[model samples]
Target: MQGSTHGIPIDTDKSSPIIVDLIYRLKIRDVMTSTILSCRPEQTMQDAQKLMKDNSITGVPVMVERRLVGIVSMDDVINALMTGTMGQPIEKHMSRQVIVLEDDMPLSFGISWLDKYRYGRFPVLNAKKELVGIITSRDIIVTLLLEMNKEIERFEEATSHREASTSGFHLEYTTRRFDFEMAGRLSTETKRQLKERDLPPKIIRRVAVAAYELEMNQVVHSAGGTVRVVYDGNQGRVEILAQDTGPGIPDVESALSEGFSTATEWVRSLGFGAGMGLPNTQRVSDAFSIESSPAGTCVKVTIATEERSNP
Candidate 1:
């Protein structure tokens, strides 16, 4: 089974630049909860249940000093309770066959293991093979989202420094508001063109994301707009412009905030706007900007053609 790496369901090998960079950048040790509450081998099953209840957790590692001996899940406790064994020592009912994640392993490995084992959490072991912390799927999710938010904020701060470049190729497409069906056509075409030109996969992905976000913003929020693509073959840069005719965004500052949007209820139900458009575009682009007025809104994104897109 494919491991989901993000809230939007990402693959370990392929995903948004922001996410791929994040998963690779982080390690299991960084995300796991270091302050662990545990149950000892001699502790009763009833004790494990209480520990879980008090901490709002589903599983407790049975520990001997600093060593992890086994894990007793809520399921084990329930079975023990129904079978009238809640009074039994936790070690007796705990799953002796433990799966663990190494502290130094990449977060991607943790994600895959969580998916593969279908476990609610895994014990984390240091090089000396001592239990250092515990990691859960929820832990992975929360860290990624929080880190992504911080990274996006950093990108937004850099948007004022637009890349200085000259254009080599140009193309434009008209986008109708609420045109969900055809919304991604421009980015799709742009990606294919870049791929045919033998551009690096990494840069191609950043350009595709920048173009798609710009295109999607116009389609989902603007009245009607034009998506312009300017590819500089010399510098290997892709500049995209998404400009709408009218009914401009009332608050540009609020619009740029992630998870803030003006998309209608029906549009949101279709999953169009969780308010990541501008943030995502700005995040992927090496240079970005947004200008709006009662007449219209225009978003600009620039991604370099170099293999190291951001550098």
Candidate 2:
């Protein structure tokens, strides 16, 4: 194999190749160049060409009955032109010989296959054979670079989370039988962490808002709860757990509604009974789940360090 200009050594000329670790971990989801662009196998070659031109891509996956059955590249088109075939369908010229990888497979196997087989790109699919993503040499290289950076960041963060968790500092608070005063405290703590770590403000805000609402739900309805804050340089997360032994809300759907509250008169006096708690919590969280029972209620909230757009 020929080494890339990027100074990556590859025995490209060899029939059998082994990929190195530096190149393997580059398949990290956050980093990876992929062509989400695809074309149906039955589509005309012209349509396939149009898709490639529009996306500025050299190749496109071929789908049949919504399943990835093959792939077609620019080289296929050239072969058609040279053979006096211009108006053929994609399936007629596309390479039915398909190669794929799982999302969790190490980048090494993918790289080795690519090098040994002389493929420009490969599709990434799950066990269900669903087309989740694509991987190319460029994508692999980019992923490698990103993994290197993320590794350093994770190491730094591990040190910080350890220091904070072991700082021998204890902060505790008690919530009344039914009150929401301490609901925003966890969020405030998370915000402070974001500012201290210089995380993106937009992402921090979303995490904080989500954490606060989850915290408030516990305080307002549950018996009590606690929050543990941790930060690792690349990301920060907050874990909040609230629990109580009370008759849980009968209808989870109504409880999750915006502007829906069942607070008693005394509880509502604190301006804490707005029905936005559950809905707002879900809105701000990257992942949201709930479980409850009549005997007691428990809620857990988590906040990520990175910013994500609402779904």
Candidate 3:
């Protein structure tokens, strides 16, 4: 960081950890400008200069057909102007010893190359060694700033989620048909959320069980649905809702009955569709309701925690 190539001001030791991660995580292709203005080697240096001027760029890569052969920078144009050589062909005046960056390299590598060479820009090549784009210090800075802002937003949103568990909060998630892999995610999330609160273990277990059963119901029984949890901190209650676009349950009574299941053979083979999902959810809840139709089915369950507000 101390003896960096040049122009790049990032010091890994002192910069935010998030920024350091970004430099390493982002690839050259992610930051470089894919839409590039290039010049044929046979074109006049004046032509490259005009391209730079019109585009407000400091450098341009010189290409021979599709191959990148050289680059002309602002200094090159200035020298040509001072020496009255602007009309000379690019191939004759362009710096032929071009330093290039590969599209797959990390942004950290680009930062190093830019500082190491102190060049205005670097030609970007693909795995096939084809010229694809170009990179500059400005691009790295702008992209890092943009990505850092996004990370900050995510961090803030997570903090808000933790806070919402104490206040009145409603969280919703989409569940897919037969997505057994994700079946317990909402329940696990519920456990994690309640564990941070002052609620008793019995109350927490009831909420987690209700969440898991409802989430599993959507994954195994419903075509697909949304699972929602609303915590009424003032009333010391947690409400869980499973609403599904459905062919509708033929027997709502059978669905609520213990040891009753409509799940197919394949679902049962996966150790699901035990017919206990709705029963378990309803057993753990202080309030329960179910509505079914050809259009959809919605089940709501509420767990009453201790009569206390969040600390």
Candidate 4:
């Protein structure tokens, strides 16, 4: 549970700029934004516009009698006014069915919400009918990207700075071109690395699941891929890069669907391509990102030492 940034020790007592990444680990309760600006459900469209401008935000949660009833955004106000209905009540246009996240949920869950929903922001609430804070898409992106870069730097530091232990084990493998045989080899190397590092049982399982799905994606869909495993100090982490030069998935949205598949009959006979590889990768990896195009696809997955408890 020790957290720091850029080799600088972080103080647990004070709120500082770097405190975000550290406080994020302690628990969501401590880092929530408590001072929220809310509006009434029956407020006028003009009222919402002024509130948004005053707060420099695009939306505000609508609370009736201190209870969150809906969310009113600038868009809702504009839509109301643009139709020559400036005098209309805000409730007519406000989104009553608001999506909320509990204060205890990890920042990782916010990633899934942003990816799955069209809203650019979210309302954070506590168990006792209290608005704790707002967790926006930008916040989630910044936290994850920072954490991912931190991990990459940590890996580079360990590989270049510290000397390998005399009694330790080392195994490296490189993969080129996409083929069925190569998939099995990558999987084997992954299990071998987990065994050698003696990583925590929970982390090992998550890494294995993510690796299996990623390798299969490259073998069945992409042009080529690479897998590497290294032991760094007392903990272990796995990094996998899968790249391919085939006609990339034209529609990432469709590909991420639960039962959508582009695999041919030959590939399907192997019990592969239930259209769950990418989605499952998203579900399993602690940090997952995708950059894809018609020319190729590149996917990166990382496993950290920190354990996540799901509700």
lDDT per model, in order? 0.84, 0.67, 0.85, 0.68
1-311 in candidate 3: lDDT tens per residue?
Answer: 34332544676767778877788789999999999899998889889899999999999988777988888888999999999999999877889899999999889889888878879789999999999999998998899888987898579559758678455676677899889877786777677667767678999899889888888888887789999988887887999998999867889999999999888999899887889988888898889999999888999898888843753
Judge candidate 3 at residue 236 and give its lDDT.
Answer: 78
Candidate 2 segments whose C-alpha is farther than 4 A from its true place = 1-35, 152-311
RMSD, one per candidate, in order: 12.9, 17.0, 13.7, 18.5
Question: Which consecutive 10 residues in model 4 have the weakest lDDT in total?
Answer: 1-10
Candidate 3 residue spans exceeding 4 A from truth: 1-16, 166-311
> On residues 1-311, what C-alpha lDDT tens digit does candidate 4 reach at each position?
23432323344335454445443563444434567888887788888888888878898988877688889887887888789776777888889888988888755345456666768778888888577787775565565566666766467546733454642323334444446755655455556556565667677677677777877887777666555445444544556666666568888888877789988888899889889988988787767778888888877776665564752
Off by over 4 Å in 4: 1-178, 228-236, 308-311
- The TM-score that candidate 2 achieves is 0.43
Candidate 1 local distance difference test against the native = 0.84
Error of 3 at 75 (Å): 1.0
Query: Highest lDDT, which number?
Result: 3
Model 4 root mean square deviation, Cα atoms: 18.5
Model 1 spans > 4 angstroms off: 1-14, 163-311
TM-scores of the models, in the order given: 0.50, 0.43, 0.52, 0.42
Task: Sort the predicted structures by lDDT, highest score first.
Answer: 3, 1, 4, 2
Name the lDDT value of residue 79 in candidate 3.
91
Clashes of each: 1, 10, 3, 1
